[model samples]
Every structure is written in structure tokens, then in C-alpha cells.
Target: MPAPHLLLVEDEPRMAAFLLAGLEEEGYRVRWVDRGLPALEAVGREPFDAVLLDVRLPDLDGVEVCRRLRLHHPALPILMLTALDAVEDRVRGLRSGADDYLPKPFAFEELLARVEALLRRARTAPALSELTDEPLRLDLTARTCTVGGRPLDLTPREFDLLAYFLARPGQVLSRDEIHRDVWGHDFDRGTNLIDVYVGYVRRKLQEAGCPDRLQTVRGLGYRYVPVSASLHDDTA
Candidate 1:
């Protein structure tokens, strides 16, 4: 496989140079952009495997850029870089559509590890095929989902989560498994990110007039029951 293409969006000259050199040395194809608008344009013009976005940008806030990027490429993995380490700041980044959050002053190795993890997950994800469960259909190649023949506007993470569950219909997945498979990270029992994303998927599925096929297994993580299957005891 070719080296993963990465987009580096950081305004600080010194920091950008450091990241660009380090990432290139690590065998990644790196494109460095200093401002938000240029970064947006670059992504629109080319395909990138992942993005390292700094929160402080010259033209637009990184979070805003992240949101816009999500609209354009809902499946692209985005790792947010920020000087602020507060929980709220991290939450803001994730809420804005970033797939992962890394505070600044972080070690280069950690950043590379995160990027590699994202790439691994992206590569290993189920092949691009139309996955269907009767009324619910997920077009993996197009990255579009429809429920009852009506499209659902799902966020990137939401789409991934739903796809993950739909791929393994009727299997009871643990939170740890879901975290590792969907988020490409070890599960942190303390964090509620998985549950939040699951809820997001559930809400969209509900809004699309699909049955709450996302069944909660009490202590177990969750399961997806195909609409064709019997739902005698499945809990939404």
C-alpha cells in the first residue's frame, strides 16, 4: 500500500515545520497548510487519508473548519490539535466532527501512533459494498445511508458506528469492542463517547422512521437486529 496522505493544518511556522518533517520522516505523504481556507480548498481538491488540524487558525476556527470538512467528506478521519487541554475543549473538538483529539505539547510518537491507528481502522473497515437490512440500507462506497428509502443525514462518526453495528447484525458487541472497532482506540470505560455516538445513530435511525433496530442488551454494549428478524424482545 502507498504511504497514507495526510493534511497538516497548523498556522505556527515552527510547529508546522516540526510536524511536517516528523510526519514525512515517518513515511507519510504530508501536505502542510497554514490557514483554514487553504486547508479546506486542499481537501476539496484532493483525497487525504487523515487530517491533523490545529484549533487556532489564521482565517477560521479549526472547529468550524472541522464542521465544514465533515459536510464535504463525512468519512475522512480528523485528529484535532489544540493547546488547550481542558475536557470541554476536547469535547468541543469531538462535537465539531473530529474523530480524535490530541492536545498540543504532545510527543511526536503519540501523534504518529494516533495517525497510524486511524489509518489502520480506515483500511480494515468492511469493504465498500451495499449493506442492507431490509428498510435500512448503507451504501459503503458512496458513504450514504437510507432508511425506508429515505436518506438519513448522519455525521461521520454516526455513520461509522451505525455501519459497524449493521455489519454484524444480531451480535452483542461490548463497549470495548465497539470502541476499538469503531473509534480505533482502546476503550476508556470512564468516557461516554461511544454511548453518545450510539445515541446519535439511534436518533437519526428513529427520525428516518426506521424501527429502533439498535437494540440495547442491558449490560452488554449493543446489537443491530435486521428489520426482517423477529423483534420479540429487542430493546431499543
Candidate 2:
């Protein structure tokens, strides 16, 4: 297979240099751009496998660049890099059509893992089937999720999280297990990344008028209790 082509858009010289060297070392074809316009132009000229976009750019907001890229290349995998780790910031990136979000000051291992997962999903998307937990259904192929037959708008990460839960009904999943399985990363004790995403999915499910399928098991992790059947939330 050919090397994955990646476009890196960052304004900071040192950061760009660091990422450029690391990505190159990992045997990826990376194109560096200092501004948003150039990044867009570059993508138009070449077929890139993925894009590493910074949220703050000199010429344009990285989120807007992502939105534009999504409009033209809906299937293109985009990972947004930013210093902000707020829930809204992450949601904004995903809403702009980013396949993944990695905050700045992250380990290169995590970035590489995210990029790989996005690429893997892209390559295997056509072979995926819809996952369902009764009223909640996730069309993995279309990347669309619905609850109770009503379409629910989900961020890429949120959809993946819910799909993971639906795929393993009644199984108590630890935080570390969820992180490793869902996003190809080990659980970080210092970060609440897993919790934040779980909260998002739970809230969305509730908003869709679904039951409290996700239950906190005191000292243990969580489990998906399907509503269609009499699945007990027996996690402890």
C-alpha cells in the first residue's frame, strides 16, 4: 500500500517543525502549510488521505477551514489540533466534520493512533453494517445514528462511542477498556476524555427520550442495558 498523505496546517513554526519531523519519521507523506488558505489550495491540488488542521490559523479559523474541506471532501479524514480542551471546542471541531480531535501538547503516539483509526474506518466503511440496541440504531456505513427512529446528529467521536456500547450489550466496560477499544488509546489517568465523551452520548440519548441505558456502577465501569429486552444492569 502507498504511504498515507497528510496535510498539516499550523502557524507556529516550532510546533509545525516538530509535527512535520515526527510524521515524516513515521513514514507518512506530510504537507506543511502555515495558513488556512494555502491548506485549502493544497488539498484541491492533491489527493490527501487525511488532514491535521490547527484550530487557530493566521488567515482563517481552523474550524472554518475544516467546514469548507468537509463540504468539498466529505470523505476526507480530518483531525483538529488545538490548545483548547473544553467540551465545546472538541464538539466544534467534530461538528465541522473532523473525524477526530487531539488537543495541543499531546503525545505523537496518540495522534498517530487517531490518524490510523480514521484511515481504517474510511477504508472499511463500505463493509460496515448498522448497529442497533432496539430503538437506538447506528448506521455505521453512513455514520449516522438515530434513537427511537428519530435521526440524531452526532459528532464522529460520539457516534463511535455509542456504537461501541451498542455492540457490547450488558457487558460492563471499564474506562481503560473503553478508551483502548473505542479510540485505540490506553486510558490516561490524568485526563477525563473518556468521561466527557460518555457524558455526551448519554445526554444525547436522554435528549432523544431514550431510557437511562448507561448506568454508573459505583466503583466499577459502565454497561449498556438494552431496552428491547430484560437486560439487567448488574454491574458492581
Going through the candidates in the order shown, the clash numbers are 0, 0
Model 2 TM-score, all chains together? 0.54
Angstrom error at residue 42, model 1: 0.8
Question: How would you encode candidate 2's per-residue C-alpha lDDT over 125-151 as one tens digit per residue?
Answer: 763367777687888657788777899
Model 1 regions more than 4 Å off = 127-236
Q: Considering every candidate listed, which one attains the maximal TM-score?
A: 1
Weakest lDDT window of 10 consecutive positions for candidate 2: 227-236
Model 1, residue 79: C-alpha shift (Å): 0.5
The segments of candidate 2 whose C-alpha lies over 4 angstroms from its true place after superposition are 127-236
TM per prediction: 0.57, 0.54
Residue 42, candidate 2: alpha-carbon lDDT: 99
Pairs in steric clash, model 1: none
